[model samples]
Target: MSIQDYPSRLSDPKSRKTETFSYLPSMTDEQIKAQVQYIINKGWNPAIEHSEPENAFSYYWYMWKLPMFGETNADTVLAEVQNCIKANPSNHVRLIGYDNFAQSQGANMLIKRGDM
Candidate 1:
């Protein structure tokens, strides 16, 4: 089949990994909590976003209307994750941690619980 016929290959062995859980299985809530706590300890603020594009290569994304900063508690972070999940349950959702000191994202994680 031609590349245009298929948007993605589920079995691609060389899939690029850009974040902590990019390659392996998706993380549990506890794992996310611990990681977010770590980032908060470092004074980073977290943001959440979601999107449903025509293909995996699309660049379109929509940030949630809610604010992205000031919450450091793990439970709060996980709640936002759940909120993101609810908002875009069937598409791609991401949790990004921004370092105020560096003015750049330190953590970028995406999750999709079911087939696309």
Candidate 2:
């Protein structure tokens, strides 16, 4: 067996990291608005959270604020996401749909990537 016969190493530093919707291209503002609408239609409370790139996968993410309970407007939720990104430009921002009945997260996705 020679090096030529072996496949390249699997450890590539340039490889992109994986997370929710990582496989898909970055979402646009319109696309994000659509998703927010879907969450509201599902009666899920929208919430924002952010974390440093290093802690992106940590169990605990810093909540932007209390979930927008009884929120019927998608724009309001999207605004909060923007606020979170502005406050934490160097951190990853995500939106979560909380199901009060299920008492857990029903949907989640990364809306912004950190500069670092």
Candidate with top TM-score is 2
In candidate 2, which residue ranges exceed 4 Å CA deviation?
Answer: 1-16
lDDT of 1: 0.67
TM-score of each: 0.72, 0.84
- Residue 65, model 1: lDDT of 60
Over the stretch 1-115, how does candidate 1's per-residue lDDT look in tens digits? Answer: 6644323354652343434566568877677777778778877787777766333345666776664577768787778778778866775677778888888988777755323
- The worst-scoring run of ten residues by lDDT in candidate 1 lies at 5-14
Question: Residue 24 CA error for candidate 1 (Å)?
Answer: 0.7
For model 2, residues 1-116, the per-residue Cα lDDT tens digits are 65433232335422445364865689999999998999999999999988887776569899999999989999888888888888888988888899999999898998888865
Q: Supply candidate 2's per-residue lDDT for 113.
A: 83
Q: Which pairs of residues collide in candidate 1?
A: none
RMSDs, each prediction? 6.4, 5.3
What's the lDDT for all of these models? 0.67, 0.83
Best by lDDT: 2
Residue-level error in angstroms, candidate 2, position 99: 0.8
Q: Candidate 2, 39: how far from true, in Å?
A: 0.6
